[model samples]
Target: MREDFGASALLKIQELERKGAKLGMAQKILLAETGTVEQVLSILTGSPIRVNVTSQSEEKGVISREVVLTSDAGEPLIRARSKVYCRNLPPAVVEKIRRKRLGIGTAIFSAGLETFRKITKMGVNDGIPYRTYRIFYRGKVAFEIREEILLKGGPGGI
Candidate 1:
């Protein structure tokens, strides 16, 4: 859990707009999209991304992980923290995540799980734009993720 998840420092896009916010194109995409961050980053960077799980743990029926997505050349592009409810996930999905072998999106897709993403919040903290979303499986939220875009211009100004 992040200390600033509830901080007033990060404001929603609508609120920012009312306050005259000027966001770059890439920032808008990152803040508004309801898709997988891995795919979005790949498209923006035009490179395959490697998922690096820095830490993972399970407690009280919840699995959590801190992850980074990097370009093939090893430049970090995004930082993400996700927590999945174990009860909502299939065993295979849980195992894949526990093994730290794939991004949360990939693991779910590889397991052939049908899911939908809902953007719960979007904000910028310390000049880094981020979005918090929930992935639903069988109409229940299986994953809660907050991803921070690390690139300044989102690679090649995309």
Candidate 2:
């Protein structure tokens, strides 16, 4: 892959990691073997990933937290976390969504209809929203989200 392509591919992989997808070494190798970065991107993102969100409010403060996962089955394959801030719609939250810190469902819920509209508008010109994210814990691959909307919507709309 070209340098930019490699970077894009890596970004997609990171996005998958953020979304709680546990990728084995073999999967990584397979991604490399796919040759075209677009192909790799397709494989990494072409499905919905899972996430969990939690929030708490006290007299002095309000706290929102999120966890992303690869599956809703038994245990999650991977995970990521973030603290929601006052903006309600911070770029960090969007970044977290892109990175998969917030799963697709949670992002949609957290972002609400307006944010979704914003994302759809942005996504129109961006080809597909591509993001880089990380995994806090690692594990074996148990399942993958097979839905395309979950995969392609990216972090912007989450």
> Which model scores highest in lDDT?
1
Compute the lDDT for candidate 1.
0.80
Tens digits of lDDT, candidate 2, 55-90: 323222223343434433423332323333323444
Error of 2 at 148 (Å): 23
Screening candidate 2 with a backbone cut-off below 3 angstroms (N, C-alpha, C), the clashing residue pairs are 18-100
Tens digits of per-residue lDDT, candidate 1, 1-158, equal 56443243234665765655555666676777666677887887799999999999999989988999998898887899999898998988898888998998889878888899878877677777778889999999899999887766533556
lDDT of 2 at 91: 53
Which sections of candidate 1 miss by over 4 Å? 1-22, 154-156
Q: How close is candidate 2 to the true structure, as a TM-score?
A: 0.29
Where is the poorest 10-residue window by lDDT in model 2?
116-125
